[model samples]
Target: MKKDPSIMKENMKWTLAMDEVFIQALLDQHYKGFRMDGTFTQTAYNNIINELKEKLGIEFTKSHLKNRLKTLKEHFKESYDFFRNGKLSGFSWNPFTKTWCAEPEVWEQLLQEKPEAIRWKTKVINH
Candidate 1:
C-alpha cells in the first residue's frame, strides 16, 4: 500500500547550531528544576520546544528533542569512556582543539577495538 504523503513526515536534519540551542535550553530547564530524578519533566520538554521554536524558528516535537538528546548522551558516554576511563593508553583530549589526540599507532589499535572512536577524533560537541 502506498503511504499518504500528507501524513508522512520527513526526518529532520539537526544542524550544529540547532543542537547547541537545544542543549542550552535543556540546561536552562535543568537548572530551573525541570529535571528531577535524572529525567526531565514533560513541562521541561514543552519549554525546550518553545524555546527552540522562538530561537531557531524551527518547530520540534517532544519526540524529536528526546531522540536527539538520547543520541547526544550516547556520544557523551563514549567520549567520556575513551578519554577519562584510563583503560586506553596514549589517548589524550586536546581542550584547545576540542578533539581527541593520540599517536597514529595508538589510534590504529583503538580502532581495532572500538571503531566508533574515530567519529570523535575531530567532531567537537560543545557540551
Candidate 2:
C-alpha cells in the first residue's frame, strides 16, 4: 500500500519533549543568546535539572536534556535555515550567534515549501 504523503509529513513532525514546559524554559534560557560559545554548559545543565526537581518534582537525566534540545532544534529547522555539527553541545551550537538561534524566517516562500499537515505532537513522559 502506498503511504499517504500527508500522513508521512505529519509523522515527520518531531515528537515533543515529555516536559515541554521545562524544555521551552530551557530553550528560552539557554538557546537564546549572542555569545561565541555553545549555548549549553555543564553548570547550566546541573542548574536546570535542579530547578526541574525543585519546581516540577521531576528527576531528569542528562540524556533527557540532550534529547529535548535535539527535538527543539528540529522544530526550528521546520521554519529556518539552521545548521549544526559535532556531538553534545556542538550539536545545536550555532557559530554565528554563538548560541542556538535558528535564524527563523516567516517568509511565505519558505513556509510554502513545507507541507500543510506538519505539526508537533507531545509524547507522554516516560521519565
Score every model by TM-score. 0.80, 0.43
The lDDT, on a scale of 0 to 1, for candidate 2 is 0.48
**Top TM-score: which candidate number?**
1
Worst 10 residues of 2 by lDDT: 117-126
Candidate 2 residue lDDT tens string, 1-127: 9854543332232333445556655665565442126667666677777776676665666567667667666656632332223232222444444443222343233235644412311111222
Off by over 4 Å in 1: 1-10, 85-87
State residue 119's C-alpha deviation in candidate 1, in Å: 3.4
Q: For candidate 2, report its TM-score.
A: 0.43
What value does the lDDT take at residue 4 in candidate 2?
46
